[model samples]
Target: MSRIGKKPVSVPAGVTASVDGQTVKAKGPKGELSFVVNDEVLVKMEEGSIKVDPRDDSKDARSKWGMSRTMIVNILLGVKDGFEKRLEISGVGYRAAMQGKNLQLALGFSHDVLYPIPDGIQITVPRPTEIVITGIDKQQVGQVAAEIREYRGPEPYKGKGVKYAGEKIVRKEGKKK
Candidate 1:
């Protein structure tokens, strides 16, 4: 028996879960997400919980049973609570500001870099040097954050660039004299 697969996924308030053949859909306040689980994994919706059961005892079926359950659970949570990533500018004159739907970044370059924020992702500037990324889908939020951070990655010498808040950069000595 798979422990994780046997666990019951509780239905939270304002969240609805429905199983249709091989696909499962979860709807919450933030948004709605659907996942098509493996055919070998038998998913059943009970009174207020969803259960995943594998049709076979094979290794592959057992693994998929648990994996599919976890994926579906994450989608449910994501639609209910969402996800957020916070980033900060770490240079003398590096800063970020919201210009309409675009992010204006001044990263000690000759000209400011303008990054157009993607749809379904929200960018907020709590402070001049701080950036907050929020969205329902974890993958999209992370991808957008990575793209922004790549514009001016943290440097080892001066540790100047865009990075996640509280991230540590290993500073290196300029030269060996």
Candidate 2:
């Protein structure tokens, strides 16, 4: 028995849910998303709620049951509230700006880097040094943010680079004179 699987996901207002065979589709103010229920797990729509059930107690069923439940819940939340990731530029000359449909970043490099924003994802620069990524798909939002930060990872000395907001960087001591 999976505790998470047993819980019913509440359908938010303005969100619609439908089930067809092993597939579940959810549409909300943000957008629409579809997911295939695991073979060992069963999903059903019941009175404004989505329920997940494990077929059996076999090892495989137990393993997939929790995952399927989590996926369904995330889908519901994503369609309704969406997700967001915040990034901060810490270098002296590093900055970010939105140009047309692309993000222009200056990370102390010789040349500026341009990253095209994909459909359904919004990148906003609240400040020259701050980046805000928003999207319905949590995974994609995180991936884009991580890739941007990788262009200039935080340095241990001055902690200069692009990093997640509120992230802590441990400073390394300089060599003795």
lDDT (Cα atoms) of all candidates against the true structure = 0.89, 0.89
State the TM-score for model 2.
0.92
Using all chains and alpha carbons, the TM-scores for the candidates as numbered come to 0.85, 0.92
lDDT per residue for candidate 1 within 47-165, as digits (tens), equals 88988899888888998988888888888887899989999888888899999989999998899999999988999999998999998877789899999999999989988899998
Candidate 2 lDDT by residue in tens digits, 1-177: 777777888887888988888898989989999899878888888888888888877989888988887887777889999999999999788999999999999999999999999888999999999999999888889999999999998999899999998899999997898
| lDDT of model 1, residue 90 | 80
Top-TM-score structure, candidate number: 2
